[model samples]
Target: MPRPKSPRTRPTWRRRFALALKIFVGLGVLALIGLVIAVYVARAQLPSFDELKSSPNGQMIRVHAADGTVIVSLGPSYGEWLSFDQIPTVMRDAMVAVEDRRFRSHIGIDPIGLARSAKLAIERRGEGRRLQGASTITQQVARTIFLSNKYDVGRKAREAILALAMERKFSKDQILELYLNKVYFGGGAYGIDAASRRFFGHGAEALSLSEAAVVAGLVKAPSRYSPTADAEAAVGRAGVVIRLMQETGKITAAQAAAANPTGVALAPAPRQNSVRYFTDWALPQLETLIDETTRPLDVWTTLDLNMQRAADAAVRANAPKNAQGALVTIDRDGAIRAMVGGTDYVSSNYNRATQAVRQPGSAWKLFVYLAALEAGHKVEDKVVDAPITINGWSPRNASGANRGEMTLRTAFAYSVNTVAARLGQEVGFGTVADMARRFGITTPVDTRPAMVLGTSDVRLLDMTRAFASVANQGVAIIPYGITKVTAQGETIYAQAVDRSQVLVAPYVAQQMTDLLQTAVNTGTGRAAQIGRPVAGKTGTTSSNKDGWFVGFSSGLTTGVWMGRDDAKVVPGLQGGTAPARAFATFMKTAVANRPVEEFDTKVTLPEWALEPDEESYFGQPDNGVYVDADGNPIDQPAPPAEDSTDDGDRVAPPAPVPQSEQNPEQLDQDWIDRVLDRTPAPAPRPTPTPRPAAMSAPPRVPEQPSDRVLIRPQEARPTQ
Candidate 1:
């Protein structure tokens, strides 16, 4: 009752309360001023007007063929510029409806829209619903042109301030034009004009309602909404845009229902040229050519368009779905004229021609045969084509039948496994490996007997280059792709003139070429023969996993391989079938206009090896013969058992009998067979004297004078 009677009695407290309220209000006003000042200062540090106007148009690479024709364009391709009035009204309405429904009535910022968006975001979070964004058209223009796309409070504050500045400087139409002109629309398109041309192949002014909706939907995620990248996603996004347009009254419900995403027309994508394989190979070379640059690059290459077309057609027609074919054509000077890496580059960009490391199979016999010739083995030397095993592994002939007592030339033509293996042991394995490396084969070689039959893995590129050496008359040549690269109309790099060194002796190369010619003419590679003289080899792996034909005309070296990426066997396919046919198809077109040339067949055998002597063969023809360092025929021995048939169809030789029961001649013959079989020679025992009943026994063979010799003659003694 006392307080109610005199409320005014607390005047001092009332005055103090009033003064505190005024001070609080003053601090709030000062804080607001500081915030405004901070926002303006941050805006000043953003991208300058000149920097925004001079943004880089993405880099482009233009690859040209050897004939100076533009084969293809790589990288982002931007179209002509578009103006605000040139943009279709439907496109504008579509963007406005999807991006900002209240775009026309709002200022640079919309507090009500922000509040509504925030409330919905909170409700969605609690209800597990998708959130909605509240960026205005002005704000998007500001961010795309002058701000980073970060989403923290500082970025939001700066975005708001810059949007206000943009609104104050330009009208709504100008802000919209800026946004439409600078926003990305996927496939490296940066503006509405480029997007329209890339997607519709027309100007922006010609966009239809459905097309406009598609363009509008791409604003969310250009790559995801790009029709080329994902047509289904793009169509779904366009339907969403159409629904939003209907809800916003930009289009009637009937119109929205009538706009079918499937009915939307899109331009055909540009044809992807097979030459991309060459560009992929040549792109890395650009870094070495130009250290670094922002300018457009023009690369001049050695690719012949006609040859590329021929190679592509050949592979497409010949290669199976599960299998792929790779073809590389290199000139004698080492310039790559054509290269087809795979069947379809779009489906798979793997470059089989350059990157696949496959077992060369018998194609690798080129190196083996070359090594033998260099080590003093003649093409006409005799070798038995009987079944033979080395170190517990017996390699069977592909034909499943062996020819008996054939010359080395016949053995090579038939791809005889036993003869090749026997020859590998005669010529040191180390020598074969060295010869392969000397010819530019970087693959590691194992000296095991299986390696001689082509177990080592080698890249098709390396093999092609090695064969190019044979075509170049023993000069080793390194394959090259790009000729030169220019940047901004100035030459940045030019390839150096190729310098080749002799790796194989001319005589040896000629002999090898002769061997290969026989292979193509009458051997397993008969399918690879062209109208012009061709010399090459055919190779098939153990399980038919890889089929290959690597051959050369006098002017070009071409290699073709057919196989699965997973190393699975192609059913019933062999090197003489798909691979050889593809090579012939490509080469026939490849050398149409070139002059016909033959391989240089001149070769001279060492004087001592020119003729065969009585010592070359044993008394019987069924036994194997021997050759010395100078390729002279050394000696041969008769079969172990007197009943042993002269035919080469005999089984594995019986193990050596005990020396004590045999005459000196039988002991000598047994030791010689062990050496030929690569079995360890028996330990020396006291010589046995023959009885008068076995006077046919010959002189005892002596030990090899040097370990390097595969066979050495016995020392002669004067007869009593």
Candidate 2:
């Protein structure tokens, strides 16, 4: 009986063992089936070899100046596609040692490395640490070419399957070529070829062992290990790669030791062109002309590199220590030839020339004078420059003093603030704003006493365009930089040559030009005189926060602004100092060898049009709309209603009609009577009562020539 019991225990043990074996076999079978299904699915998702080869890779976009010189290159570009033979043995070995130690031995996926990594990853998960990646070079290529960068296990499985499939589809050399080309190096380069040329200024095959090691190290972290960006970090990374090469038997110990050079010979950084601002300004235009996924286009711009350099030098030499400077030069045809957005773009790239909006100060007087001229005011018209107030807001001269009455031209040349305010009021703020818009100043203009003094914030580029209209003899110029765009050698876009409309009457513009010339000759902008005929104005804000000199030569119009970004006052900074000197320095070089040309001195208005009138230029309507400070409409008493007749005939009043309600015929008769002495013009009607009060604070005093303390002439001129 005892023997029978012992035999039954052995059978029980065998039965238990059999059950465990069956469970293990079933799980094994299921895992095999799952792996086969995953492989099949991944295989179907993989892109075809030909399709992968032909996919759009990053390409270069070249920007050229007007003279066909390459100013800069912009791109997400692959330098030059290279075959396996084109890659040097040293570079290939360095990349293999650093990126994938068992690249050649593994069939795309390294099972040993993956298992070890998984073991460590499992342990790290328990410790709550990040898992390390164990992807081979082939797996990286597969992930780059055919898979999205997903981090889940399912994606890893797919990546492994695709990598295995790639191994079967292409030779090791082919896979290596693709890997080299697909990896990203720094500075917008995408491949070894581009990276080599970008960092070393040479082709991949020309890379030395040390250079190759540095280039290979960049594959791990392009920006961190860029030879051009971080020389120390790049050399340190190269040392690691060199050590790995020695450990992998790719190079002898002596060779590895010899390769440890003190420094890497990175290419010298390209000189920053003066037209960098132009490219930056044109980039948005380029984006609009071509789609994001479209091939790179050649952007031909109207940049004159020589002039750009000159402008850049002038800005750097003239800008104050605490201030930044901007300069822009436009041709007579509205072509932007040169633009220096800041003294040093590398230090700050805010593009002050095109992007910053600051008070124009006295430079804005141009529009006020033009508006007055358009309203039948002659340059010689007398304007009282005594202290003036509107709605309890008094505007004073910069010195807090004023000249008695002065001619409009003389007042303008001296930058008389009270007279400009008076002129703005006589012509109407709306009329001044309209004149600004017509001259291509698109920024919002506040209709205030100070607006005539340029209290409104306006872009430097817009101001340059506005002055260009005066230089161009009233033709409206829309400033532009891009000239043409080509893709695949086909013209995709070209700046259409549109005829500019007449913004100001030629005669009015001529008169304004003459006044500006007077300003440069002996007034506030005398610092801007360049020997040749020139016209310009100087502007300095109340606190000396903004200084400007905007002017034009016969061949070019240029504007310069000097200011601190934070709007802090720069001591001794005035438009006549730094900005005017910059304009003179830049214009001297810009107009070299060109004959000095004079402005057309002819005034376009008729003799009668030169006489002042009571009504505003655009005519005050009967709807009671008047502009307040800030350009908002203010309700004013409408002109007294005239008696209406139903007989379709109008009667001329015998008594002298009131100025506000007089018809055109009555005004003409009154003017003719005054001119011919037939009847003495009725004593001028009293100025209408002030409009509704709107201003909350006093108007700031505007800069004036008399107020300016001419320090030393050397203070105005910057050292070269």
| Segments of candidate 1 deviating more than 4 angstroms | 1-50, 53-133, 141-150, 162-178, 181-194, 201-210, 220-263, 268-325, 331-352, 372-427, 480-497, 505-515, 543-545, 563-572, 592-720
RMSD for each of the candidates: 15.0, 15.7
Best TM-score goes to which candidate?
2
Q: TM-scores across all candidates?
A: 0.63, 0.70
Best-performing candidate as measured by lDDT: 2
Q: Output the lDDT of residue 453, model 2.
A: 71
Model 2 — TM-score against the truth? 0.70
